[model samples]
Target chain A: MSATEGFLHGLQLAFTPELLLTALIAAFVGTLIGVLPGLGAVAGAAIALPLTFMFDPVVGLVLIAGIYVGAQYGGSTGSILLNIPGDSTAVVATFDGYPMAQKGRAGPALAITAIGAFIASTIGLVFIVYSSGFVASFAITFNAVDYFALTAGGLLILARISGGTLAQGLLPMILGVVIATVGMESTSSYPRYTFGNLDLTLGIHIAVLAVGIYGVSEILYLIEDKRQRASYKKIRIKDLVPSRSEIRQSWGPWGRGSILGFILGTLPMPSATISTFVSYRMEKGIARNKSQFGKGAVQGLAGPEAANNSAAIGSIVPVLVLGLPFSAVLALMISAMIVHGIQPGPLMMEQQPDLFWSVIGALAIANVMLLVLNIPMIGIWVRILQIPRYILIPVIVLVASMGVFSVSNNMVNLYLMLALGAVGYFLRKYNYSLASMLVGFVLGPLIEDNFVRGMRVSQGDPAYFLSSTFAVVIWSVVVLIVIGAAVRTLLKRRAQRRLLDSTAK
Target chain B: MTLEPRTEHEAEPGGENLETPPEEHVEGRRSGSVVFATLSLVLAVGYVWMAFDMPNGTSGDPGPGTWPRVTGIAWVGISVLALIESLKVVRTAPADLFPTGKSLKLVAFFSAATVAYVILLPILGAYIVSSVYMFYVIGLLRSKWDIRGGIYAVVFGVGASLIFIELLQVRLVAFPW
Candidate 1:
């Protein structure tokens, strides 16, 4: 189907009563998860995985997508209200948002955030509609070796970009690949790490691992912290309306941030976080009154908030076109698609145009729904913030456990989830990036499959992997990424040393 | 290129300056890194040893074990480098990272309770096990047992059971009887 035809079909699918209701509920749930401090988009997606299974693949995907968009909207709430970021991407919002709140302009900050997010997402959706087909057309030509290069390059880039030392990122990712090898090997049907357990043959479900790592681990961390409850003044509906000048001030930043965010979001990295930070820096750089930055500049809040939502929408492009997930949340979306027997690469556009277009349509619908839901429901979200940790903790744990169990009705998964949760906690405490690990796990099988296939086609010549021009280019990019990371680390260390020396003087 | 956006705050003109890590905290982090590196090295070695038993095909027709073997070897190298790096840093971590004794106790109690709940789930059924687990955990988290906690736990347990078992038709063992 043509792009226009597919999009129309998607719109038709999205408007169905059942799908609309699903999108609405997903938006509310997503926002709620985002408003909560510890529960991020990854955890929200993991918790909702089982419930999605009950719906058709299109509806299920829409639900997941809606939740993601909703979470993006909700993530700013905590940052604005309490200076605590709901997710890493929302961290930028806290720079200006909390200050605005301190100045009794909390309502305007939130109102502007919702408006910026809506506009940015709409802009991003337009880009996806126009650009995805072109990208997929190019991607369809990728051979096994090229695919191997792409996946390997993607993993290396992610590890290099994920915060902290390279080893800290790589070890967890390698561990994820090792975990992927636990079940039967696809080519030879040889079980690599089953260890005589029958259940091991079935392989670990991605949702189970996600729930364990993101959901269960977060719960443990929250329990360990023993943080005091956040107290914020009750916000009324009238308080949500931003001043006319505030809205006018947001326009320029929103346009610039949306464009920058869309461009950056297509890369194989933590696009939302990176885009928001870059947008903040750009806004601050261009602002006439720079002193207002950390003191509640309208541009600072508007730019990053726009970038956050745009980057989120932009991140979906690579997933849709190349069937490669650059982040953990996208990986979960891919997993959902795979579960429904829908292959996600370029061919999906042709074979499952309805599914493809509907997802895009649902995203648009969900973005619209988020605007309608978040503004009026700001008060409810503030109430969610007031929920006692004790109550929220048990509810999260129960939901995580139930979600894992419902995957295949296997008790073994529950045990695995608990075990992984403990491991996740330790790994997190040590500053290892769990997002890298998850992306590794999701992409591991594909890497192995492509590697083995390329080897077979070449009659076992390893050099065949580098024979293709595309493969060579990808490898070069990977090398450049590593070199770049090493240089950055050295510079940071030098800067730290200089600062320390000056302090001593 | 760097996604560590929080670090940008340090460069902000009027941003709150991030404090340098205290000596004790730095030492604690170093020690923690060393322990983690050691554990990772051990695990990597174990994985490599296991990979030895699997059949590795020729370069042209690599078998199922080839990927795992390569991954294991890479892991071993990374872990060794990490261990060396950790050893070079001179610092000592805290005896325990947990903030207070009570926080540690909460984690331990909750962990043990969860394990027990999972074990008893099949035998006692979802409703009973879930209700008891929720109540106990709620009280543990609040650091007090209360009637309201009990009531919420029961309601949650029953509500969850109904939704998953009856409404969704999930094949969970709902009742032992």
Candidate 2:
């Protein structure tokens, strides 16, 4: 179907009463998830996944998409109100947002965040809707060699930018690829790591892995730390509307952030956090009086929040077009799609056009719903933080277990969930990149499949890796990213040495 | 490219930065890196050994084992690099692992209780098992337990029933008997 036709049909599906209610419920859950520290969009998706099973496929997708999109907007609440980031990406928001709250402008900071997220998501969605069709069409034309190059290049870029030392990120990624190879070898149908256990033949379900990592591990992490809940200042709806000066200061940052976020998100990396940081830095650099930064600067609040939401939408583009998940949350979405027996790829747009368009439409509507829900309910969101951790954490665990068990009604998956949860907990403690591992797990099979196919086509010529111009371009980009990281690390070490030497002298 | 995103004021997973003495902090980090790298090296060696046992078809006709072997080699190379980098850090200072006793105990108990709850689900059913598990958790976490705490646990465990069984129509594993 054409983009316009798909969109129109999606409008029809998304606006239906059942799906509209699903959007509202998802937005509500996403907002709540965003309000709590240590609970991210991935966790929210995992916890709420079981509930979606009862709904129609489109409605379920809409709900999950809504939660993912809404959580990004919702995270600013905790950041602005309590100096706690609801999402890790919102960490940048706390620099300016908390200060605004301290200065009696909490209302305006939140208003701008919500508004920024709304506008940026709309802009990002427009690009996604228009470009996705083209991406899918172009992807369909690509052969095995091109596929191999793109996926391999994407993985390399992901490893480099997975938000830690390259080695730290690559370790988890390698582990994920190894884990992906556990149950059954695609080529020979031979079990590699199943240890002769029949239950392992079906492989670890993606939902099981996701729920374990995001849901159970997060609980484990939260329980280990004893943190006092932040006190909330009573807020009124009237206080949430932004002032004209604040609104004026926000427009330029919003525009710039949306563009930057979309472009970065479309790239094969974890873009939300990176985009927010980049937007925050860009705003700081361009501001007339930089001292206002971290001191309730509206531009600081505006740009990062806008960039974050835009990147959230931008990340969905690859998931739809290439069936590649760049982040943990997107991986869960793909798992949800797979659960419903719908494969997410370029062909999905062609074969399941209505389902595809409805998801896009649902995300667009979810963005609007967040703006509507957040402004009036800002007071309630603040109050949500007041819920005691002892009470809340138990409920989360129960829900997590139920969600995992509900997927297949098996007890072994519960065991697997616990085991992986332990792995995730330790990985986080050691500052390993869980997101990189997740991306690796999702993309590992695709990479191996494409590589094997391309090799078969080339008659196993090792030189086929660099044969095509496209392959060469991809490899060049991969090499450049690696070299760039190495150079930066070296420069940093040298700078540190010079500083240390000067201090010693 | 400059990947040091964790500046002094940046919020990490647990919100507050660890406020160890400067020397201790540096040494502690080095020890942590070394430990992780050593563990990764062991795992990589095991994986590579397994890869060696697999059938390696000719380059012209790659087998299922071929890609795993390639990945295994890559893992070894990177693991060695990681070990070297970690050793460089360790050269600066060496510190033993620090443990917060209470927190570790609490985490271990919490994890164990969860495992027990899941194990008992088929025998005792979700309602009874989760309610007891929730009660234990909330009681353990909260300093002074009130009857209301038990009520809350019961409600949560029962709420799972209402949603998963009644609302969603899932035939959750109940009493095995």
Candidate 3:
């Protein structure tokens, strides 16, 4: 079947009454976490990820993917109305969204952003719908050595480019590889880091570690801060409605931003700061009210919002196709897939078309759901902001701790979560980038084992990477990413210095 | 080609003039971060060293600890660089750092309560061990006063016990001394 036909079929499945209801629930719950500043989609997906173990991996993955997109859209609710960016990505929304709110134009801001997110999301979903099978097919052919080279390339990209200290990034990751080595050598029956404990026979569960490090640490974050008392402001219900002129103005950016966001989000080396900046600049340059930009431009809000959301979609492209996660959050998503016995890569399209298409379709529905729900539930989303953190975190902690505990019924897993929580706390304190470390922890084993095994098979001849033209092409691309990021950073610094000097004169 | 709008504080990112240490009062304390990092570095290096002795690829070939050992060394190397960079006292209160003391104490108190639960689990059974432990942990974190905290603790504890031990079929030691 053609890719378009496949997407249409997936849509038919997604739009069924049962799936529709599920999408709505996912959006509502996702919005709840998204609007609450400290909580995020990653945490939301994870907290709910364990619950999906009993379900079909495709259904489970779709639900989580819906929540993932839904959360990004909902996050703007906090940023626009409350003036607090829900997460780093949503920070740009506040540039114009808050200003719109302050002017009692929050309705238009909400409408436009929701509208923009939905449009951008549709664009991204369409991209995934077409490309997932192609990408998945490519990954199925990766032998151990090819897998190794890709892993090494990915590790370096994740480490150097993952937006934290290269050293700090590798620490937990390298430690994880050592930890993975503990139970037994995967190929041989030899034990390495077990310290001779009988329980060590079974390797550490990456899921439990992710649940603790990413999931539970979030609760710790909430507990450390003063509980957020939901506060309300001048939110005129009328503000939820957008003017015709406003809608017309927002349309262009939504289209442009969707394309921009998709590319940025998909790239291994992100242009996060710039994607928004570029969108903001592009919209402003073309916008009639150019001078109003920085003051309160609606286009400013639409462009960046589109860019970031598209990037989120873009980020998923590589994962569905190649079984490679360019970011930490995606790494966790890959883990979730692994737990369900559904390996993602090229073969998955033929092996599990239902899963691939459902995920893409689910994202599409999530965006539509966001548009449908954003305005009517503005009051509900706003009200949820006031839920006290004191009560919230304990429940969260209880759920996470209990989830980890129940998985293996291992009393040891609960204790492990506690210990990892402390280590995470310290890592945060030092401004060491947890993202790279997380990326490392997730990708460390994949890269190391694959590269080593592949090397061994090649008998130290590095031409193993070149035997297949595909490997050569991928490595070359990875090399380009590394060089580009290096050059970009250097140039960015130079530009900043020159700007500073010019301003000084 | 365009500029990112940055906050003033973010500029002069690495200039020593931005955060000169109070050398007189806090010399050793200031150095603690680096010292701790170095110690971790040593430990990481040790792990890598041990990895070196690990057997390389079998007859068909797959080296035992080659990847972990190499990664460990790389990790150590990265730490050394970060240590030097971090010593400057940039004074930017980086977000996502350690919690304040009171909250930390409460966090520890809950952790200690869990430890107590682990110790008591075999002796007291799943229900009893979890019951008292939950109550104690919540009380330590935030006392709602009176029976509210108690109610929450008991409810959660009971829910946990049934879900974990009864429904999921975890082995719950029922015998207590």
Candidate 4:
């Protein structure tokens, strides 16, 4: 089928009562999870995975897809209102978002975020519709060497760009690789580091790790700082409507962010978090009023939020086409699809074009649903902050623990979550980048697999790594990015020292 | 609560009305850095030891240990550099690094409660264990006991069970309460 015909068919299928209803429910649940701190979309999908067991596979896929998109929209709410990120991508939003709230422009900040996200998601959907086939065909030609280089390039850039000293970032990243090696070794069927525990042999599930690190660790931090629990001013509906000037200023950032997000999100990288940071930096560099950033600039809010939503849509391309997931959330989405017997790959496009297109259509519809549901409901979401922290914290804990436990129905998961929660806490305390670690862990097995395969194909000749043009190009980019990051960090530190010296004088 | 629009000058970036203070450029204390360095070093050593125990086939036909051993050696080098850098730093206690006395006690209580909640979950079931855990956590956070807290705990516990069990149909291992 032609792309146009498939899109129309998918749209027709998406509008049916059952699928529309599923999308609506998933949107609500996704937004709810995003609004709540520590309960991310990964948990929502894991919790919802079993709920989809009885439904048609397409409906199940759509439901989880809706939830992922909704969470991306809802994530900015906490960042704008409470200075707490609803998720990691929202961390960039909090830089300017919370300051806007303090200045009584919280409504405009949030409104711009919604508008930017909706616009970007639309463009991202279009990008996927047009470019996914191209990417898939390109992926078909990729040898193991290309895959190895691509994965290594992603890890290197991620290590360089993640906030903190290079050593701090690389430590968590290397630790993640170590953690990923815990289960049976893929080549020889030999267990690497089970340490005699049967449960360890199965390896740590992503849900368990995410919930423990992102969810439980957040709770510990909040508990450690009671000041973070203070309530904010209740939001009014009038506060949500953006002024003409604010909306006009946001358009440029929105466009740039959408393009940036789509390009980055389609690549073999952790798109959502990385796109937001990169978009914010780009906006800051290009802004007419550069000083406004990190001080409640609407461009700061608009760009990152747009990138985040666009990246959410762009991330689906690889999963739908190449069957590779670049981030933790995408990994869970793949699992959800697999459980429903829908194997996502190039063959999926050929075998079930309707299903593939419908997934895309569902995401587009979900983006619309998010805009409609979130704008008028901003006041309600902000009111969530008014709930007493004492009451709110425990409910969050209960939900998080239950969600993790439900994934495998094992007590070991709960314990593992609590243990990793402690590890995550200390990691955060010492300024290690958890996202980098997570990227390392998620991409570890794939990297090892591709490398070993490439080597075996070349009869253990290391020279084969540089044999392919794609490998050479990818490695070149990796080297350039790492060097660029190091130079930038040195310049920034020197500038800071000069400022300090001038102040002293 | 009415929010008044600030003066235009105050709203401008880098103006006096900034909501939060500029980030202070405080250097980290030696103790914290030392702690992190030591932790990394110890972990790297253990990892290298484990890697050595596994078979290391020739470079031509690598075994399970190849990737890990390379990572472990690099990790050791990095940690030692971190250790050396940490030794040159002076001591200072930032708020995030060191909690207040009251917060310390709360941290202890929170940790203990979490451990207890995990251990008692299967034995008592999600419904009972969650309620009691919620009740205790709320009491500590609020620094007092109240009927409202108990009510909140009950609602959350029952709500979780209903959603996870009856609605979502997740098969959790729980006592038949």
Candidate 5:
């Protein structure tokens, strides 16, 4: 279908009163969970996913997608107002967004983020419509080696951008790959790391770990490092909503961030999180008012916020076409699709156009609804922050532990949760990020199975990995990035030494 | 932290001696990192050997060991990274450990109650286990310290319990007794 037709069709279905109401509710709930420090979009999406099962798959997908979009937008709200970012992507926003709030420009900062996110999301949706077919066609050509290379390239960037040394990022990634190996090996009939325990042989659930890391451990972390018991002051509602100038200024970053975000997000790693950080850095490096960046540049807040929401939209291309989950939330969303006997791949658009179009419609509506709902309600959310940390954290911990344990009604899960929590707690202590580790855990099996399958076909010819044009292209990119990183570090050191020598002379 | 940070437990002269097993420094790194790494290593090694022993994966597929071997390799690789990290921090970084007394007490108290709730679920059914667990955990986290707060904690907890059991309708821990 044409882009205009797709846009009009999605708008027509989504604007219907009942669908709009359902989306608004989802947005509200998603925002609530996403605003909380310990909870994140993945948890918000997963917990809310099963609830949507009772609805028709189309409606269910819409509501679920709504929650997904809302959570991304809502996460920015917390970071912009309070310094505590709800998710990792939200961390970048806090650098300027919260600073703006402290400077009584909370209104403009929140305004840019809310409006920026809405505009970027729209641009991203347009890309998904125009490019999904192309990506799907391209994906049909992906073999194991090509897939492996792409995954590696995405992962390398993820590790490289997570701050600190290459060793720092690689360390967590390796740990994750190992952790994912704990359950059954996907290819071999034999179980790998179950340790003779039947429950564990099934392996640790990715969802549970997400909860423990983002939900449980974070609560524990916040409790330990209580950053001011209350918000500095209430942000005026007008400041939370974008003004005309804020909207006008948003155009440059919004357009650049969204388009760039869409491309970066189609990769296999933490696409949404990475795009946000990179977009923020780009805005700072290029903005005319560079000095205002961390001191509260609305453009800094706007660019990354837009990029992240747009990246969420960009992620759908891979999910819709290749069946490769671009992020963890997509993994669970794919799992949910599996439950409904719907396979996610290139044929899905043709197979289920109505479902496809309606969900897109729902997502577009969800973004608008979040901006509409959240801007006016900053006062209410600020009160939520005042709920007394002593009471709030434990309540969250109680609910999270309860919800997870209830799934199997097994204490084994509880023990696992606690065990994972303690593990999560320690991982944080040593500054090892939990995000990539989880990515490894989930993708390790898939990566291994595919790599081995490719090898056997080549009869142990390692060069077989370089066989296909797609595989070759992907691998070339991976190799270039790795080599580039190494060269960059060497050059940096030389530059530093030269500068030091000149100073001495 | 407020009081001059006393070492929680000094074991042997590892910190004092230059040749302490190196793990002595690392041992203080969160126990989770090591355990996860070990788990990954065992998984990777076992899978590689298993796939190696099997004939060319399953029918028309890569050998059974093929996938497992990669998994095992990744496991070993990642675990080695984590182990190195934990070791580096323990040896090189000045150690900062221990939760505040309040955090520790709450974690310990909640943990014990949860264990009890798990034990009681089969006998008590989903409702009672949830009610009991939620009520106690909420109280401990709050530090509310008043009868009115206690009543509110139980009441709000029950409200949550109702949402889980009635609204969501999933069977939580079914109490046995």
Candidate 6:
């Protein structure tokens, strides 16, 4: 089919009544998850994964994608109203958004955020349409060696940039890969880590692990923290419309942030969080009246909100094109696709163009739904903030347990989920990168398969890895990243030593 | 726009604004890192030993063990590094890392309760177990036990069971005929 025809078909598929209803429900749930503290996109999606299994692959994928976009839009509401960021990506919003609320301009701040997110998501969707085809086509030519380099190099870069020291990130990731090594090996059907147990040979499910790590662990953490209810004044519908001056102030930041976010989101980084910080910095650096920022500048609120949503949308391109998930949330999406027997890489466009285009169409539809839902339902979201932990926590626990149990109807999986949840809670307390661990778990098998295939093709010659220019370039980039990290660490330590010595004198 | 000075409550880019652990609990965190590193070191050694037991064929005909072997070796090296880094500044009594006794009790109670729920699920069925579990947890989480918690719990339990078992046909254990 022609590109235009595929695009049109996708829109048709997404516009069906059943699919539209799915998108609407997903949007509402996603926003609710995002507005609630202690639940981010990853946890939200993981918990919702089992529900999607009842539908066809296209509908399941659209549900996941809708949740993703809706969460990005909803995260700002908590930041604006309570000075509490719903997630890390919403932290920047709290800087100006909360201040605006304190000044009784919360309505305008939320309006601008919704408008910016809508525009930015639209831009991101356009880019996804144009760029995915080109990227996928190029990826279609990748050999096993190239694939290995890409996956390995991407994991390494993610480890380096995923925060904390390299070892901290790498450890959890390596452990995840080790976890993936269980059950039967694909090529030889050899069970490596089963240890003579029949159940062990079946391997761990990605959904089980995701729900355990993100959903169950989050519940434990929230229980320990005992999140207090936030007080919020009711927002009427009329109060939600932005004034002419506020609208004028937001346009420039929104455009710039959208572009910046899209570019960064395509890379293997925590793009949503990083893009917001970068956009905030850019706005601060370029603003004419700098003093207006912390006190409640529309530009400050608009830029980061735009960047957060755009980056969330833009991150999907890599997953669809290369089957490389750069974030934890996208990793879950890839897992869902795999569960549905849909391979998400370059060949997917040829094999499942309808699914691919329909996802894009779903995202656009979800974005519009968010814009429409968020403004009129501002009062409801605020009430959600007031929900007591006693009520919220139990509901989440029930849902998570039920979700995991329903997937396999096995008691063992529930036991495993509980154990993993305990482990995840500790890991999180120590600041380990769960995102890195999740991405590694998803990509580990792909890396091993590619490596083995490349080795077999090349008769075990190690030089074959460097034979291709793409592989060579990828390895070079990996080396550069390592060296850069080492140098930065050394310089930081040296600076610390100098300060200590001077203080001693 | 002037950049706002970061406050203590503000979350970092890749982190959240969790409450600070108590002064006594701070030492436990430090020692907890050491314990974790030691455990990881032991796990790595065991994994490496197991990896060697499997057949690792030559480069041309790599066995299922080849990737795990390489990963196991890398794991050993990284674990050693982690251990060293963790030990560099270890100072504190090896107490439990929970910030408060209340928090510890809450986590322990919930964990135990969940374990019990799982055990009872297949026997008593999902609806009965889930309702009781939710009711108990809600009462525990609330400052004082109330009838409202019971209502919410029953609604949630039956509502969830109906949606998953009836509407979605999820094949969950339901009421015994």
lDDT of 1 by residue, B88-161 (tens): 53322333454458888888998899899888888888899889998999999887889999998999887887
Q: What's the residue-level lDDT of B117 in candidate 5?
A: 62
Candidate 2, residue B160: CA error in Å? 1.1
Q: Candidate 1 residues A238-302, lDDT tens each?
A: 99889999998999999999999999889888788888889999999999999999999999999
lDDT, model 2? 0.79
Per-prediction DockQ comes to: 0.38, 0.33, 0.26, 0.32, 0.20, 0.43
Candidate 3 segments whose C-alpha is farther than 4 A from its true place: A15-22, A134-146, A168-173, A234-238, A269-278, A281-291, A466-505, B1-32, B58-60, B87-144, B148-177
**How many Å off is the CA of B63 in candidate 1?**
1.1
TM-scores of the candidates are: 0.94, 0.93, 0.85, 0.85, 0.82, 0.95
lDDT tens readout by residue for model 3, A184-247: 7666666776678755666666556666666666666666664335456645567678888778
Top-lDDT candidate index: 1
The TM-scores, chain A only, for the candidates as listed are: 0.97, 0.96, 0.88, 0.84, 0.84, 0.98
Two-chain complex of model 3, DockQ on C-alpha atoms against the true structure: 0.26
Candidate 2 lDDT, tens digit per residue, A51-106?
67766788878878788888998888877887777778888998898889889999
Q: What TM-score does candidate 3 get on C-alpha atoms?
A: 0.85
Task: Please identify which of the two predictions, 2 or 6, would achieve the higher DockQ against the true structure.
Answer: 6
lDDT of 6: 0.83
Q: What digit string (tens of lDDT, one per residue) describes model 4 on residues A1-505?
A: 7777777778887888888888888888788878876556765565455455557888878887888888888988888877777767788888898888888898889889988989999999988888877777787788888878877677766665563555655777777777888888877988888898888877776667766766676677667654444466766778788889989889999999999998888765567877898999999999889888888888898998999889989988878987666665676676567657887777788888889988887777888888988898887777764566677667777767777777667788889889888887777666666666766776777788887787678888999999999899988887776666556755765676688789999
Q: Is candidate 2 or candidate 5 better by lDDT?
A: 2
Candidate 1 residue-wise lDDT at A417: 92
Q: Model 5: per-residue lDDT, tens digit, B1-177?
A: 011111212211111111223454456543655665566567556666755664554434565445555555655665676566544433233233556477678667765775676567556765565555655666676664567566656665666667766776656643354
- For model 3 chain A, the run of ten residues with the poorest summed lDDT: A161-170
Worst 10 residues of 5 chain A by lDDT: A159-168
Residue A462's lDDT within candidate 1 is 86
| lDDT of model 3 at position A401 | 54
CA error at residue A492 for candidate 1, angstroms: 5.1
Give residue A319's lDDT in candidate 5 (0 to 100).
74
In model 1, pairs of residues that clash are A460-B60, B27-B92, B28-B93
